[model samples]
Target chain A: MSKKELIVREEILGSNKKVAAEIRGKMEAAGVLVVNLLSSPGSGKTTLLERIVETLKPTHPLAVIEGDIETERDADRIRRKGVPAWQITTGGACHLEAKMVGKLLPEIPAETKFLFIENVGNLVCPAGYDLGENLRCVLLSAPEGDDKPKKYPKAFATADCLIITKSDLIPYLPFDLEKAGNEALDLNPRLRIFVTSALKGRGIAELARYFIESRVNMIQHQRHA
Target chain B: MHELSIVASLFEILEAKARENQATKIVRVRLKVGKLAGVVPEFLQTAFDSYKQDTIAAASHLEIEEVPLKVRCRKCTAEIEKEDFVLVCPSCGSTDLEILEGMELLLDKIDLEI
Candidate 1:
C-alpha cells in the first residue's frame, strides 16, 4: 500500500535467454548449424524453406521448426516436401521463444546437419530475441518494397543474411533491389543478401550451396576446436 | 503487438520478486525499453493495467525509461544516437556502423511494500 523501492534487477527476456543459451550449446555440441529465419507475414519464409529442402535433400540433412500463431499448416507444407519438420503454435504470441524451440529439438532427428527455425511471421519481436541460432536470416519480399530495411532496421540489424524473396516479381512491383541491399548492408555490413523466387527457382541453387558450405564449416570448426 | 503477452511475463517476474521479499504488494515497476525493442510503451501500459488486477502487482505503477538508439560508426569512430532506420555515420557519412544501445528491454528496478 506504500511506496517502496524494491530494486528488482532482471532482464526482460531473462528466462528466454537462459533457455536459448542452453539450446545453442546443445546444437553446437551436436554439430548442428541452427538458422533462425525471421520475416513478415507474406515474406515467403515457408515457400523458401520448401525450396531449400527440395534443393538440398540429397546433401545436407535438414529439419525445420515452423512457428506460427494459429496453425500447423506450415509444418505440414514442409513435411509434404519429404523432410522432417515440426510446428510450434505460439497460440497468441507474435514470436517464437527459445523454450518452444528447446522442446522440439528432441523430436528432430539427431542426424540433422542443418536446423532451420522458421520463426513466427513478424518483423519486430523475432528480431529482438535470439533463438540460439548460428545464423539469423531476415527475408524481404520484392512485393514488400525495398524500403523495408529502412522501416525495420532492427530486423535487418540482427540478420546474418538477408533474403529478398519473390525476385521474379521485381519487374512488376517497381522494387528498388539495390536500395534495399544497400539499406540492409548499412545496418549490418556482414549481412549476405540473396535474391530468389521459389516459383521461378532462381537463386535456389545458390542458397543451397551457401547452406552446404555452412554445414561443412560448422562441423569442421567443431572438429578442430 | 506482442507487448500484451510480454506484460504478462513482466508481471510474473514482479509477483515472484515481491513474494520472495515478503511484500504485500508492488508499488512501482521500473523498466528500460530500447528504441528498437518494438514495444510501444502506451500499449504495454494499457495491457499491464488491465492484466494486473487480482495479481500481486494490482496497485503497482509502471515507470518506463526509454533508451535511445546508439550506433557506433565504424568509419568515423564516433557514436551517435540513431533516430531513424538510416544506419549512417553522422560524422563521416559512412555506412559502416554497429548498434551500441536502444535494443534493450530490461526490468531495471521495482518498488514493493511489505
Candidate 2:
C-alpha cells in the first residue's frame, strides 16, 4: 500500500496534548489553580499580572510562567513583584506548548497556590494548546479594538473569563466596550467580564477577589471530594 | 507564524507514515483545517513550501480541507453551522451551545509512492 492510501489516524496536536494531560494531573494533585492568559502583544497582560502579583502578594502564593518569542523582560517585571517567575522563550515560535512547560516543572515549586502561564502574545496558535490550566483567561485591550472576538472567536469561545484591559484609555480610544463584551459573551455565554486598567489600579480589587474566590472554591471542592 | 511549527509536525508524521508503508516518497497529503483551528492556510502553504525541500515529501502536494464551525444549541437542541464566532442558536436565541465541529486540525490521509 502507498503511504498516501494508508490510514495515518494521528491526532493533529499529538504529543503536546499528552504532556498537557500530565501537567493537568500533577496540578490537580498539588492543589494548584492554573490560569493560562492569552492575548495579543501590548495587550497589557504582563502589566495586569505584575499588578496582580503586587497586590495579591502574601495573599496568594503566585507563580508565573512567562512565554515570549524572545526577551526576559516580562519575567523581570514579574520577579520585581517578589513572586517566582520562569520565562520560556519559544525561540521564534508563536505559542507555548505543554511540553515546553513540562521542561520547566523543576523550577516551579510544588506549593504554588496560583500558577499563571502567560502564553506568547498571539491570539491564534495559543488557543489550540492547553497547558493544563484550571481556567483560560483571554484579554482584549481597548487599543486592539472591539472586532477581536469576531476575528478570533475560538480564543474567546474557550475562555472562562474575558478581561478588557486599559479601560482608562477607553475614553481616548475608539474602543466599544459593550460590543467587545457582547461578542465575547455570544461565544461563551457564561464568560465573566471584567474591565480593568492595570496602570490606574482600576478593577484590580474586583479581579483579585475573583481570583481569590476561585482558588478558595477549588480548594473547598477538593477537600469535600 | 505558529504555522511553521504545525507544518514541522505534519512533516514528522508524514515521514513516519511513509516509512511504515515502506514507500519511497509521498505523493499527496490531505489535512482538515477547521475554521476554529486557528491555522492560516496561507502561512501553512508558505511554510510547507519552504520546509518540504530535501524531505520525503519534497514533491508531495498538500490538500487542505476546511471544516465549518457547527454547534448544537442546549436550549432548542438545534444544530446549526455558524460562520461567525457567535454562539447563539438560530432557531432560539439561547446562549448555551456545544461545539460540534470547527475546532479540529487533523491529518486525514496521505498518498504514498511505492
Candidate 3:
C-alpha cells in the first residue's frame, strides 16, 4: 500500500473568518458600529442591554440581533424599548456564527448608528468565533463570582472590553472587584473595563458615553488611515 | 457541544482539500491546537469519530498537537511557558505580559491517497 502526504495548510475556520470580514466591510460602509456582547446565562447581559437601548435610542439610532438557543424573548424585550430587533434561534447551537449574523444585516435599520449583536449566553463557544463586530465585550455579573476570568481565560483574552455587571449586588455577594479586575487585566492588559449596575442606573451613563466615544474614535481612525 | 460544530467545519475543509487534490480517501489529519484555544482534544476526537462516517475521511485518523501557552514579559523581556492561564512573569512576577503563542486552532496538514 502506498500513501501520499499532501501538505495542505489551511484554517478550519477560514470560511467563518471570510464571512466575518465581509460583514465588517458592510458595517464600515454603512458607518455603523457593531458590538458583540458575550456572557454566561443569567449574567445580566439583557438587563444591561435594555439600559443601553433606553439611554441611547433618542440620540443614536440603534438595532439589535438577539441570539438564543430557542426563543424570541430577548428580541421582544429589545423591541419593547422601541428599537428594531431580530432574533436568531440557534436551535441547539451554543454560539452564533458569522454567516448567520451576516444574513440578518439587511434587516437592520439602515440608519442605525449602533448595532448590538447579543450572542447566545455562552462564554466558551462564542469566544472562539468572531462576528465581525467593531467591539467585543464580555460581561461577568457579580453574582457569577470573580473567578470567571481565571476559569474562562479565552473569553477575557479575546474581548476588547470587560463589563462587571450587577455591581449593586456586590454588597451581598462575596465577589471581590479588585481580584476580578486584576485577573482580567492579567489576561489582557489593554482591555477597557466598566463596572455597571442597571438597577441603580449607576455607571450606565459612562458606559453609554464609552460607546459614543468609541464610535467617534473608530471613524476618526478610519479617516486618518 | 461546540466540538461537534468544529468537527463539521473540519470535515468541510477536508472534503474541499481532497477534491482539490483529486484524492480518493483521506488517510490522516493533523491539527495544531493551542492550550488557550479553549477546545478539549478528547471531545474534538470524539466529535470527529462520530461525524466522519460515510465521508471521504471515514477511515482517517486525527492527530492533535497541543501547543503550550507562551508569553513574553514586558518588563524583563523574558519569554516564559505556562501551563495555567495566569500571565504573570515567572522571573519578575510582573503581570505585564504579552501572549506570544497559544490561542491557535489550525489545520496543519492532511495525508491522502489519489
Model 1, stretches more than 4 Å misplaced?
Answer: A1-4, A220-225, B74-76, B93-96
Query: Whose TM-score is higher: candidate 1's or candidate 3's?
Result: 3
Question: Per-residue lDDT for A126 in model 1?
Answer: 87
Task: Give every prediction's interface RMSD.
Answer: 2.4, 2.4, 2.0
Best by TM-score: 3
Model 3 ranges off by over 4 Å: B74-76, B92-97
Across residues B57-95, which tens digit of lDDT does each residue of candidate 2 receive?
A: 899888888899999988899899987877888898898
Better of 1 and 2 by DockQ: 2
> Alpha-carbon interface RMSD of model 2?
2.4
| Alpha-carbon RMSD to native, per candidate | 2.0, 2.0, 1.5
Q: Give the best candidate by DockQ.
A: 3
True contacts kept of each: 0.71, 0.78, 0.75
1 or 2, greater by TM-score: 1
How good is the docking of model 3, as DockQ? 0.68
Descending-TM-score candidate ranking: 3, 1, 2
Q: Which scores greater on lDDT, model 2 or model 3? A: 3
Clash list (residue pairs), candidate 3: none
RMSD from true fold, candidate 2: 2.0
**Chain B TM-score of candidate number 2:** 0.95
In the order shown, the candidates' DockQ scores are 0.63, 0.64, 0.68
